[model samples]
Target: MSDLILLRHRQIPDLNQLDVYRQHGGFEAFQKAVTTMNPYAVTDEVKDSGLRGRGGAGFPTGLKWTFIDTENWPHYVVANADESEPGTFKDREIMEGNPFQFLEGVALAAYAIEAAEAYVYLRGEFWQIADQLDRQISELEAAGLLGDKLFDTDYSLRIYTHLGAGAYICGEETALLESMEGKLGQPRLRPPFPPSYGLYGKPTVVNNVETLTNVPLIITRGADWYNSIGTEKSTGPKIFSLSGRVNKPGNYELPLGTTFRELIFEHGGGIPDGRQVKAIMAAGASSSLIIANDEALDTPMDYESVPNVGAQLGSASIIVIDDSVSIDWVLRKTLHFFSHESCGKCTPCREGTFWMKHIIDRVHQGEAAWSDVELLNEVALQIKGKCLCALGEFAIEAVTSGIQRFEPDFRAKVSESSDEDELLVESEKA
Candidate 1:
C-alpha cells in the first residue's frame, strides 16, 4: 500500500491549473460518473467502498447521500471549504493545490445525487481560494464538463463558490448552508438532517473538501479497489495534518491503521529539540487530551482504535505537543478560539465558551482558585450534548480533558496567586 493518496498529487506542479489537472486525469471521474454509471450505482459504489466523511463527524458518506429526501427535488451539494479547525489543514491543501480534482468530485456528487446545482462554501478568509475555484468552474463550463446537458447525459449542474463571513460555526454543514443562503452562521437543530432537508428546504449533501475529493477516485478506481486501501472499517487513505513540536510538522497521508508512533517519529521526524512527548491532541483541539505515554503513541490512528487511547481520530488532524508546552495554555488557546468564534445563537455555547475563556485566561495569568478549574471543567460538560451542533460538543472536549487528565497543571496555576487582593480582582473578572 502507498503512504499517500490525496497527498500523492503533490508532485504535479501547476496543480491548480485546469490544463495541468486535465493532463493528470483530473476530470476522468466526472466523465466516468456521468457517461457510464447511474446515480444509484455511484452511491452504491461509494457505499461498497466503505468511504466515510473526512470531516470531523466521520459519518458514512454514501449512507449520507442515500438518506437524502428524494421527495425534495433539485437537491444540492455544498462542498464545505471552511477549514477552520485548529490542527486541520488538509482540505486547504487539496483546494489550493489540487482544486480541479475537488471540483470533479463535486460534479460527480451532483450527478450522483441528481442535484441541479452545487455550492462551494469557503471561509471568508479564503477569498483567494474562492477566486481560483470560481475560475476553475468557469473553465469547466467552457469545456462542456459542467452546465446544461453535462457530458450529454441529460444532467445539468452549476457549482458556485460562496464566501462565508469568517465564522467557525459555518464549518458545520447546516450552518454553512445557512451562511451560503446569506443568513447569520448558526447551527440549526438536526433531526431534519441535511440529507432530508437543507439549503432552501432542498435535499442537500454537504461534504468536506477531502470527503468529496475521494469520490472521483473511488468512481474511477472501482469500489473494491478503493476499499482495499485502509482498514476494513476505515477503508481509505487519510491525510493526517501533523503540526506543533514535530521536526517535520505537515500533512502526512497514510492508511488508517497506521500507528501514531510511525506518524510522529518516522513520517514527522519525531519531536523537535529532542523534547519528550508530553501530550497528543489526537484530533486537533476538539479531542480529549491524551498523555503521550508509549501505549497512547503506539495506538493506531483509526476510528475504533483512537478512542481506546481516550481520544477521537477527528478529521485525522494529529497535533503533537512536547514537554515544553503546558496543557493549561493549550486549553486556554482553544477556549479563546471557541469563544471568539461562537455564533451567539444558543445559550450554552454562547455563554459557556466565553465563560471558559474568562476562567482559562485568569488561570493563565496566575489568578485562579483550585476550585475554579473544577468549575470550568463542569461548565464544559454542561454545554456538551445541549448545543445545536458538533462545534458546541467538540469545543469543550480539550478543556474538560485537560482539567480531568492533567489536574495538577491546572491546580498549580491557582497556587501561584499570591494575595487575597489578587483573588478579589479575579473574582470580579469572573
Candidate 2:
C-alpha cells in the first residue's frame, strides 16, 4: 500500500500535538509556501496534483483557489468541517486525531488565497472537536506558526472556529457561510458563487476538512509525487468511512481507484453474520442505492468511475446493506432524516421532503397500496429538478433509486397488506 498522507497520525503517537507534528516534518510545507513559494505557485501545484474536493461535489480544489477574485481585497477562506452526512465521519477523526496537519492545510489555503482571516465552520455536535481545535490554534499562534508575519513574511493569517446549530443544510457551502454570518442556514443562488461573493460579500475559498488536509503534503512532496498515488483522474489517497452491516466498520484510507470489493470485503472484513451484501449506499443517506452486484462490487470507487454503477463516490461514506435489511426500511430512515433537516427556505425542498417522509412511512408500515408506491416515486421525480439547492435533490436520490432498483421490496409490502385485507374480508363474511 502507498504511504498514508492525511491519516499519518495512525502510525505516529501524539501526532496531534504541535511538537510531535513538527518532528515528522509537519508545517514544513506551510513554512515553504509562505517563506519561499509564490501564493499562486502553491495553487498551481494543487491543481497539478489533481486533488479534487473530498466533499460530495468533487470539484477541483486548486481551481477553486484560483477562482478567488484577485480584484477583491482581503479574501476569506473557510474550512468546511460540517460533516452532517448520515454515514460520513472521516473528517471528525482527522480533526480529533491529527489536527496540526489539517490546521496547516488551512493555513496554506489562507495564504494561497491571500486571506488574512479564515474560519473552521464545524457542526454543533462537534463542540469537543471545536474546543480541541481552538486550543491547537492558540498553540500555533504562540509558536509563531499561525499569527501575523508567519515565517517573517508579509503574509499573515488567523483562524477561528464557528459552530452550527446541528442543521444538515449547513453542510452546503453557501448555507455554511450564511450560518457563519448568523443567518438562517439556507443555500444561496448561483452565478455569484462563493469564489466571487461570499462571507460578507468578499471572494472566499470554501473547502472540506479532508480536502484542506491534503494541501500540506501536496506542497511538501510536490504535485508529481501526490499525483502518482491514485488514478490519473482521481489522484490521492481517500479516507473511506465504511459503516453498516460490516464486521469492521470504520475509516479506511486507500487510494481512489480501489474497488468496492477490496474495501468492503478485504479491508472492512466483509459483512457480519456471513450474510450476503444486498445494496451499497456509496454516499451516505443522500446516495442512490447501488445494487450490490458483481459488476458494482468490482467497480472502482472514484469520482468518475462510481457513476458507471449508478452512484457517486460522495465523501466515500460507503454504507453496506446486507440481505437481512429491506430497501424500504432504508428509504424510510433516510427520508426521515432529510425531512427533519430540511431548512424550509425553498418551497420544493421544504414541502417535497415533508410529503416524501409521510409517503415512505406509509409504505414502510405496509399501510399503503401499490398506488402509494407510485405516488412516492412521482413525488421524488417532481422534486428532482425544481429545488433551489441540492438538498431537495439529495432528499430524493435513495427514494427514486430504491423504488426503481428494489421494486420487489415495495411490492412485497403491498402484497402483505393485500393478504391482510383479504383475511379481514373473509372473517367479516363468515
Candidate 3:
C-alpha cells in the first residue's frame, strides 16, 4: 500500500515548528491556490479528487464546497478536532505529531472556500495541542502567511481556536457549530446541511482533522494522483488506528484496500498470546460486530469492500477481539458508555440506552433470566433507525449482533447464582 497524505509527515521529528514544516513544503498549496488559481478552480480540483469527509459521514469534499450559500457573506471553515469516538485516536496523532501540516490544510481550505476567518474547534482534553496550534497560527501571522493579506495577496485568513467541554455530540457538524456559537452542543436539524446554513447561519465548511490534512497534498499533486492510491469510491491512504488483542497496536497509514490480515497479522504483529481472532468492531464500537472468519480476515479494508462483510468502514478504527473476550461483556461496556453519554435530547435514545445498560449489566453478572436476553435484543432493535444521531443508533451494534451471532455466551450468563436463584424462586412463588 502506497502512502499519500498520512505518511508524508511520518519521518518528520518535530512538526510543531514553522521552519520544519515550511522546509517540507507546508504552505505550498495555500500559496499556489492564492497566487495561481482562482477559488472556483481550487474547489473544482477538490471535486475532481474524489475526497470525501473522513469524519464518518463520507460526504464528497468537492460537492460540499459547491453547496456553500454564496448569497451569504463571510464564509467560514471549521476543522473539527473533537475526536471522541470510542477506540478512535487517529486525529490526536495528526494534531500532535504534524501540527503545521494540519494547520496548512486548514488554511488551504479557508482559501478555497474564501473564509476569512477559520476556526479549529478542538476537544477540551486537547488544550495542549490547541496551544501549540495557536502559537503556530501566530507564527504564520507574523510571517505574513496568515491574516490581512496572506503571502502579499488580497486573500487574507485568520484562524481561531475554540475548545469543547468533551461532548461526543459536538463531533456532529451541526452540533459543533452550536458548540462554537456557545450553545449547549445539541444536534440541529439537517437538509439545511451546513453548506447553506451553518455557524452564525452563514455558509461553513467543517471538516475533520485527517480529512483537512489531505488538502495541501491534493492541491500540490492534483486529483488524479490522489485518486490512484485507494480502491474505487474510497481513494487515498487511511490511518488505521488498530487497538486491542494485537501486538503492534497503533496508527498505520496504508492504502485504503489493504487487507485485514496484513493490518492485524503483519502490521499489528498478530493477536496477543496466539489467541484466535473471534470478531472485529471495524470503525470502532459504532460498527456492527463482524464475526471473524476466513472471508472476513482477507476482506479489503475500504468503504466499498467492508460493507459486503456487514459493516461500514467508518474512521478505519479496527478494534480486534479474541477468544479470551466475552461478547456479552463487550456489550456491557459499550452500553454503559452510551447510557452515560446519552444527551437526553430524544426520548428513544435517552430511555432506550439506559434500559439496554441495566439489562446487559444484569445479564453479565448472571442475575437475569433467559427471557431477559430476548427482551434486551428487542429493546436494541427498537432503538435502531429511530434516533437523532448515529451515537444512539450504533450503541447497540455490539449487543444486538452479539446476541444473534454469539448466542451461547449471552445464554450462559442467564443462569443465576444462589442469591439471584433464591430471589427468582421467591418471585416465581409470588
Q: What are the per-model numbers of colliding residue pairs?
A: 0, 0, 0
Which pairs of residues collide in candidate 1? none
Q: What digit string (tens of lDDT, one per residue) describes model 2 on residues 239-309?
A: 99999999999999999999999999999999988899999999999999999999999999999999998
Give candidate 1 misplaced runs (Cα > 4 Å): 1-3, 416-426
At residue 285, what lDDT does model 1 achieve? Answer: 78
**Local distance difference test values of all predictions, in order:** 0.86, 0.92, 0.86
Q: What residue pairs are clashing in model 2?
A: none
Name the candidate, 1 or 3, with the larger TM-score value: 1
Can you write out model 1's per-residue Cα lDDT over 46-88, one digit (the tens) per residue?
8899999998878899999899899878799999999988999
> TM-score for model 1?
0.96
Rank order by lDDT, top first? 2, 1, 3
Model 3 weakest lDDT span, ten residues long? 421-430
| Candidate 3 residue lDDT tens string, 118-137 | 99999999999888888888
lDDT of 1 at 26: 78
Which number leads on TM-score? 2
Q: Is candidate 2 or candidate 3 better by lDDT?
A: 2
Kindly give the stretch of ten consecutive residues in candidate 1 with the minimal lDDT sum: 1-10
Candidate 1, backbone clash total: 0
How well does candidate 1 score on lDDT at residue 287? 84
Off by over 4 Å in 2: 415-430
